[model samples]
Target: MGNEKDSLRAKLSPMSYHVTQENGTEPPFRNEYWDEERDGIYVDVISGKPLFSSLDKYDAGCGWPSFTKPIELEEIEELEDRSHLMVRTEVRSKKGEAHLGHVFNDGPKEAGGLRYCINSAALKFVSIEELEKEGYGQYKKLFS
Candidate 1:
Protein backbone atom coordinates (compact mmCIF):
# COMPACT_ATOMS: atom_id res chain seq x y z
CA MET A 1 0.00 0.00 0.00
CA GLY A 2 2.78 2.40 0.86
CA ASN A 3 4.55 1.68 -2.43
CA GLU A 4 1.33 2.22 -4.35
CA LYS A 5 0.75 5.54 -2.67
CA ASP A 6 4.32 6.56 -3.36
CA SER A 7 3.93 5.62 -7.00
CA LEU A 8 0.69 7.55 -7.24
CA ARG A 9 2.28 10.60 -5.64
CA ALA A 10 5.18 10.42 -8.08
CA LYS A 11 2.83 10.32 -11.05
CA LEU A 12 0.83 13.36 -9.94
CA SER A 13 1.59 16.82 -11.20
CA PRO A 14 3.16 19.23 -8.80
CA MET A 15 -0.05 21.13 -8.25
CA SER A 16 -1.99 17.93 -7.70
CA TYR A 17 0.56 16.64 -5.21
CA HIS A 18 0.45 19.94 -3.40
CA VAL A 19 -3.31 20.05 -3.21
CA THR A 20 -3.93 16.45 -2.23
CA GLN A 21 -0.85 15.65 -0.17
CA GLU A 22 0.10 19.00 1.30
CA ASN A 23 -3.38 20.56 1.57
CA GLY A 24 -2.52 23.42 -0.73
CA THR A 25 -5.15 25.47 -2.51
CA GLU A 26 -5.03 26.35 -6.18
CA PRO A 27 -5.99 29.75 -7.51
CA PRO A 28 -9.78 29.75 -7.75
CA PHE A 29 -10.89 30.95 -11.19
CA ARG A 30 -7.71 29.91 -12.93
CA ASN A 31 -8.06 26.24 -12.11
CA GLU A 32 -9.59 23.65 -14.41
CA TYR A 33 -13.25 22.49 -14.05
CA TRP A 34 -14.32 25.72 -12.40
CA ASP A 35 -16.04 26.71 -15.63
CA GLU A 36 -16.64 23.31 -17.12
CA GLU A 37 -20.24 22.55 -18.14
CA ARG A 38 -20.13 19.18 -19.85
CA ASP A 39 -21.95 16.19 -18.40
CA GLY A 40 -19.64 13.80 -16.56
CA ILE A 41 -18.50 12.28 -13.32
CA TYR A 42 -15.53 13.57 -11.40
CA VAL A 43 -13.32 10.96 -9.78
CA ASP A 44 -10.42 11.13 -7.38
CA VAL A 45 -7.25 11.55 -9.44
CA ILE A 46 -5.33 9.23 -7.15
CA SER A 47 -7.85 6.45 -6.54
CA GLY A 48 -10.30 6.75 -9.44
CA LYS A 49 -13.17 6.70 -6.94
CA PRO A 50 -16.29 8.55 -8.06
CA LEU A 51 -16.69 11.81 -6.20
CA PHE A 52 -19.04 14.22 -7.94
CA SER A 53 -21.28 14.47 -10.98
CA SER A 54 -22.08 17.28 -13.40
CA LEU A 55 -25.71 16.88 -12.36
CA ASP A 56 -24.78 18.16 -8.92
CA LYS A 57 -22.48 20.91 -10.16
CA TYR A 58 -23.49 24.57 -9.97
CA ASP A 59 -22.01 28.02 -10.23
CA ALA A 60 -21.66 29.38 -6.70
CA GLY A 61 -19.81 32.46 -7.91
CA CYS A 62 -16.91 31.26 -5.74
CA GLY A 63 -14.65 30.58 -8.75
CA TRP A 64 -14.37 26.85 -8.09
CA PRO A 65 -16.15 23.72 -9.23
CA SER A 66 -18.97 23.64 -6.68
CA PHE A 67 -21.27 20.72 -6.17
CA THR A 68 -24.29 20.10 -3.99
CA LYS A 69 -23.15 16.63 -2.96
CA PRO A 70 -20.83 13.76 -3.69
CA ILE A 71 -21.78 10.97 -6.10
CA GLU A 72 -22.22 8.87 -2.97
CA LEU A 73 -21.95 10.01 0.62
CA GLU A 74 -19.63 7.15 1.45
CA GLU A 75 -17.06 8.25 -1.09
CA ILE A 76 -16.18 11.32 0.97
CA GLU A 77 -14.84 11.79 4.47
CA GLU A 78 -15.15 15.09 6.30
CA LEU A 79 -12.60 16.33 8.79
CA GLU A 80 -12.44 19.41 10.94
CA ASP A 81 -9.94 21.83 9.50
CA ARG A 82 -8.40 24.52 11.70
CA SER A 83 -5.84 25.67 9.22
CA HIS A 84 -5.08 29.36 8.59
CA LEU A 85 -6.87 30.16 11.87
CA MET A 86 -10.31 29.40 10.45
CA VAL A 87 -12.58 26.52 11.32
CA ARG A 88 -13.79 24.68 8.22
CA THR A 89 -14.86 21.25 7.13
CA GLU A 90 -12.35 19.57 4.90
CA VAL A 91 -13.66 17.05 2.42
CA ARG A 92 -11.44 14.18 1.33
CA SER A 93 -11.70 11.13 -0.87
CA LYS A 94 -12.34 8.10 1.31
CA LYS A 95 -10.52 5.63 -0.91
CA GLY A 96 -7.51 7.72 -1.85
CA GLU A 97 -7.44 9.87 1.28
CA ALA A 98 -6.78 12.78 -1.02
CA HIS A 99 -7.74 16.22 0.18
CA LEU A 100 -10.36 17.24 -2.37
CA GLY A 101 -11.43 20.56 -0.84
CA HIS A 102 -13.70 22.25 1.69
CA VAL A 103 -17.42 22.12 2.27
CA PHE A 104 -19.41 25.19 3.18
CA ASN A 105 -22.90 25.68 4.47
CA ASP A 106 -23.81 28.18 1.77
CA GLY A 107 -25.22 26.82 -1.47
CA PRO A 108 -28.38 26.83 -3.63
CA LYS A 109 -31.23 26.14 -1.25
CA GLU A 110 -33.19 24.07 -3.73
CA ALA A 111 -30.31 21.83 -4.59
CA GLY A 112 -28.96 21.55 -1.05
CA GLY A 113 -27.62 23.87 1.58
CA LEU A 114 -24.01 22.73 1.24
CA ARG A 115 -21.34 23.62 -1.25
CA TYR A 116 -18.47 21.26 -1.96
CA CYS A 117 -15.79 23.55 -3.35
CA ILE A 118 -13.43 20.98 -4.81
CA ASN A 119 -9.94 21.36 -6.20
CA SER A 120 -9.55 20.47 -9.87
CA ALA A 121 -6.12 19.03 -9.31
CA ALA A 122 -7.62 16.34 -7.10
CA LEU A 123 -10.14 15.17 -9.67
CA LYS A 124 -10.39 13.78 -13.19
CA PHE A 125 -13.61 14.17 -15.15
CA VAL A 126 -15.01 11.16 -16.95
CA SER A 127 -17.63 11.98 -19.54
CA ILE A 128 -20.78 9.91 -19.79
CA GLU A 129 -19.71 8.31 -23.08
CA GLU A 130 -16.35 7.34 -21.67
CA LEU A 131 -17.65 5.79 -18.47
CA GLU A 132 -17.65 2.26 -19.83
CA LYS A 133 -14.22 2.50 -21.35
CA GLU A 134 -12.85 4.09 -18.22
CA GLY A 135 -14.12 1.26 -15.99
CA TYR A 136 -16.91 3.32 -14.57
CA GLY A 137 -19.71 1.65 -16.48
CA GLN A 138 -21.78 1.13 -13.35
CA TYR A 139 -22.03 4.87 -12.97
CA LYS A 140 -23.50 5.28 -16.45
CA LYS A 141 -26.89 4.50 -14.95
CA LEU A 142 -26.64 7.90 -13.28
CA PHE A 143 -27.02 9.51 -16.69
CA SER A 144 -29.61 7.05 -17.93
Candidate 2:
Protein backbone atom coordinates (compact mmCIF):
# COMPACT_ATOMS: atom_id res chain seq x y z
CA MET A 1 0.00 0.00 0.00
CA GLY A 2 1.16 3.49 -0.71
CA ASN A 3 1.56 6.01 2.02
CA GLU A 4 -1.55 8.17 1.93
CA LYS A 5 0.26 11.34 2.81
CA ASP A 6 3.19 10.76 0.47
CA SER A 7 0.99 9.51 -2.34
CA LEU A 8 -1.21 12.57 -2.12
CA ARG A 9 1.80 14.85 -1.92
CA ALA A 10 3.43 13.24 -4.92
CA LYS A 11 0.33 13.67 -7.02
CA LEU A 12 -0.95 16.99 -5.70
CA SER A 13 0.72 20.29 -5.12
CA PRO A 14 0.93 21.85 -1.68
CA MET A 15 -2.15 23.96 -2.24
CA SER A 16 -4.11 20.98 -3.42
CA TYR A 17 -3.40 19.08 -0.24
CA HIS A 18 -4.72 21.87 1.89
CA VAL A 19 -7.88 22.20 -0.18
CA THR A 20 -8.81 18.60 -0.83
CA GLN A 21 -7.67 16.83 2.32
CA GLU A 22 -8.39 19.67 4.66
CA ASN A 23 -11.83 20.41 3.21
CA GLY A 24 -10.67 23.79 2.12
CA THR A 25 -10.84 25.64 -1.17
CA GLU A 26 -8.50 27.92 -3.04
CA PRO A 27 -9.63 31.43 -3.62
CA PRO A 28 -11.30 32.18 -6.91
CA PHE A 29 -8.94 32.17 -9.92
CA ARG A 30 -6.04 30.94 -7.81
CA ASN A 31 -6.39 27.30 -8.83
CA GLU A 32 -4.15 25.68 -11.43
CA TYR A 33 -6.88 24.48 -13.74
CA TRP A 34 -9.07 27.54 -13.60
CA ASP A 35 -7.63 28.77 -16.90
CA GLU A 36 -5.81 25.72 -18.13
CA GLU A 37 -6.18 24.81 -21.80
CA ARG A 38 -4.52 21.50 -22.36
CA ASP A 39 -5.34 18.32 -24.26
CA GLY A 40 -4.93 15.44 -21.85
CA ILE A 41 -7.24 14.32 -19.09
CA TYR A 42 -7.33 15.42 -15.48
CA VAL A 43 -6.61 12.56 -13.13
CA ASP A 44 -7.15 11.95 -9.46
CA VAL A 45 -4.46 13.70 -7.43
CA ILE A 46 -3.96 10.69 -5.19
CA SER A 47 -4.58 7.57 -7.26
CA GLY A 48 -4.31 9.04 -10.76
CA LYS A 49 -7.71 7.97 -11.98
CA PRO A 50 -9.05 9.74 -15.04
CA LEU A 51 -11.99 11.72 -13.71
CA PHE A 52 -12.78 14.62 -16.01
CA SER A 53 -12.12 15.29 -19.65
CA SER A 54 -11.07 18.59 -21.14
CA LEU A 55 -14.02 18.34 -23.47
CA ASP A 56 -16.36 18.70 -20.53
CA LYS A 57 -14.53 21.70 -19.11
CA TYR A 58 -15.95 25.20 -19.09
CA ASP A 59 -15.51 28.57 -17.46
CA ALA A 60 -18.07 29.05 -14.74
CA GLY A 61 -16.38 32.19 -13.44
CA CYS A 62 -16.72 30.67 -10.00
CA GLY A 63 -13.06 31.11 -9.06
CA TRP A 64 -12.49 27.37 -9.14
CA PRO A 65 -12.18 24.69 -11.81
CA SER A 66 -15.62 23.73 -13.02
CA PHE A 67 -16.65 21.04 -15.44
CA THR A 68 -19.94 20.54 -17.23
CA LYS A 69 -19.92 16.86 -16.51
CA PRO A 70 -17.71 13.99 -15.55
CA ILE A 71 -16.08 11.73 -18.12
CA GLU A 72 -18.06 8.79 -16.79
CA LEU A 73 -20.59 8.28 -14.07
CA GLU A 74 -18.74 5.33 -12.62
CA GLU A 75 -15.49 7.22 -12.34
CA ILE A 76 -16.77 9.23 -9.39
CA GLU A 77 -18.98 8.90 -6.35
CA GLU A 78 -21.48 11.44 -5.13
CA LEU A 79 -22.58 11.86 -1.53
CA GLU A 80 -25.20 14.11 -0.06
CA ASP A 81 -23.41 16.93 1.68
CA ARG A 82 -25.32 18.71 4.39
CA SER A 83 -22.54 20.74 5.83
CA HIS A 84 -22.67 24.45 6.60
CA LEU A 85 -26.45 24.55 6.74
CA MET A 86 -26.78 23.78 3.04
CA VAL A 87 -27.47 20.74 0.93
CA ARG A 88 -25.04 19.92 -1.82
CA THR A 89 -23.68 16.91 -3.58
CA GLU A 90 -20.15 16.10 -2.56
CA VAL A 91 -18.07 14.50 -5.26
CA ARG A 92 -15.12 12.24 -4.68
CA SER A 93 -12.86 10.14 -6.80
CA LYS A 94 -13.91 6.56 -6.44
CA LYS A 95 -10.52 5.22 -7.42
CA GLY A 96 -8.41 7.57 -5.38
CA GLU A 97 -10.97 7.92 -2.62
CA ALA A 98 -10.10 11.57 -2.39
CA HIS A 99 -12.36 14.51 -1.70
CA LEU A 100 -12.67 16.30 -5.03
CA GLY A 101 -15.28 18.97 -4.47
CA HIS A 102 -18.97 19.37 -5.13
CA VAL A 103 -21.57 19.29 -7.85
CA PHE A 104 -24.25 21.87 -8.27
CA ASN A 105 -27.35 22.23 -10.41
CA ASP A 106 -26.68 25.81 -11.37
CA GLY A 107 -24.41 26.02 -14.44
CA PRO A 108 -24.47 26.94 -18.09
CA LYS A 109 -27.71 25.98 -19.75
CA GLU A 110 -26.01 24.53 -22.78
CA ALA A 111 -24.07 22.07 -20.63
CA GLY A 112 -27.10 20.81 -18.73
CA GLY A 113 -26.66 23.41 -16.03
CA LEU A 114 -24.65 21.02 -13.90
CA ARG A 115 -21.43 22.42 -12.62
CA TYR A 116 -18.89 19.99 -11.27
CA CYS A 117 -17.01 22.35 -9.02
CA ILE A 118 -13.79 20.56 -8.21
CA ASN A 119 -10.68 21.24 -6.20
CA SER A 120 -7.41 21.70 -8.04
CA ALA A 121 -5.72 19.76 -5.28
CA ALA A 122 -7.81 16.71 -6.09
CA LEU A 123 -6.73 16.82 -9.70
CA LYS A 124 -3.57 16.73 -11.83
CA PHE A 125 -3.77 18.31 -15.24
CA VAL A 126 -1.85 16.47 -17.97
CA SER A 127 -0.75 19.06 -20.48
CA ILE A 128 -0.28 18.53 -24.18
CA GLU A 129 3.37 19.25 -23.80
CA GLU A 130 3.85 16.28 -21.47
CA LEU A 131 1.21 13.88 -22.78
CA GLU A 132 3.34 11.76 -25.05
CA LYS A 133 6.36 11.89 -22.85
CA GLU A 134 4.21 10.98 -19.89
CA GLY A 135 2.84 7.87 -21.62
CA TYR A 136 -0.44 9.55 -22.50
CA GLY A 137 0.20 9.57 -26.24
CA GLN A 138 -3.18 8.05 -26.91
CA TYR A 139 -4.83 11.31 -25.93
CA LYS A 140 -2.82 13.46 -28.32
CA LYS A 141 -5.67 13.71 -30.78
CA LEU A 142 -7.72 15.56 -28.22
CA PHE A 143 -5.73 18.69 -28.79
CA SER A 144 -6.03 18.64 -32.55
Question: Per-model C-alpha lDDT, please?
Answer: 0.93, 0.81
Q: For model 2, name the residue pairs that clash.
A: 16-121, 28-63
lDDT of 1: 0.93
Candidate of highest lDDT: 1
Can you write out model 2's per-residue Cα lDDT over 1-144, one digit (the tens) per residue?
A: 559778767766778787777667777787778888766688887776678878888888887788988876798999998888999899988887778999999988887989999987688888767878867677677668
Q: What's the distance in Å from true for residue 131, model 2?
A: 2.4
The candidate maximizing TM-score is 1
- Give the 10-residue window scoring lowest on summed lDDT in candidate 2: 134-143
Q: Please report the TM-score between candidate 1 and the true structure.
A: 0.94
lDDT of 1 by residue, 13-118 (tens): 9899999988989999999999999999999999899999999999999888999999989989999999999999999999988999999999888877999999
